[model samples]
Target: MRTLEALATGTPLVASDYGLEGLSVDSPGTPLGAMRANDVDEYVYAVGRLFQDEKLQEKLSNNGRALIENEYAWEQMTQRYEQVLLDTCSKYLVESQE
Candidate 1:
């Protein structure tokens, strides 16, 4: 949730891969400039890199914000949830009638 907030606010991110499983932020073909930190050392290194590289920080910040705006905005996420709830309720209603 905090990550979403950060992304929404255009903050550059360095997060754990496990925390970003479905988003594919650090995976192959990831569109965002986010870096993944697997451990403490990597986390430190990633933070240092961001601090040292202004261009990289800017790229990551922009990409993170764009990604959220495109795919994970509150309105989009809520619509998806509403669809899931409606679908599940419809399915159960049909099954119960049988």
Candidate 2:
């Protein structure tokens, strides 16, 4: 939730892999929305790099905000959840009629 908030606000991120688990941010073949770091040294390096690199920061900020708008916004999430429930109900009805 916190991560989503940051992304929604277009804030650049330096988060641990575990902190971003299950998110599409660092998925294979996708652009990263946050810098991934797992240790203190890595975190420090990532933060420093992000701070020093304005282009990287802007890229991350835009990507993160776009990700949230496309995938995690309330409208998008509600639609996905509604579809899941509808599919489940339809499957159950078909099975019960069999």
Best by lDDT: 2
What lDDT score goes with residue 8 in model 1? 77
Candidate 2 structure quality by residue, lDDT tens digits, 10-57:
999888877787788877888879888999999999999998999999
Residue by residue across 1-98, what tens digits does model 1's lDDT show?
87778777988989887766567566567775588898999999999999999998999988888889879877998999999999999999999999
Alpha-carbon runs more than 4 Å astray in model 2: none
TM-score of each: 0.84, 0.91
How high is the lDDT of residue 14 in model 2?
83
lDDT of 2 at 13: 88
What is the lDDT, from 0 to 100, of the residue 33 in candidate 2?
Answer: 90
C-alpha local distance difference test of each model? 0.85, 0.90
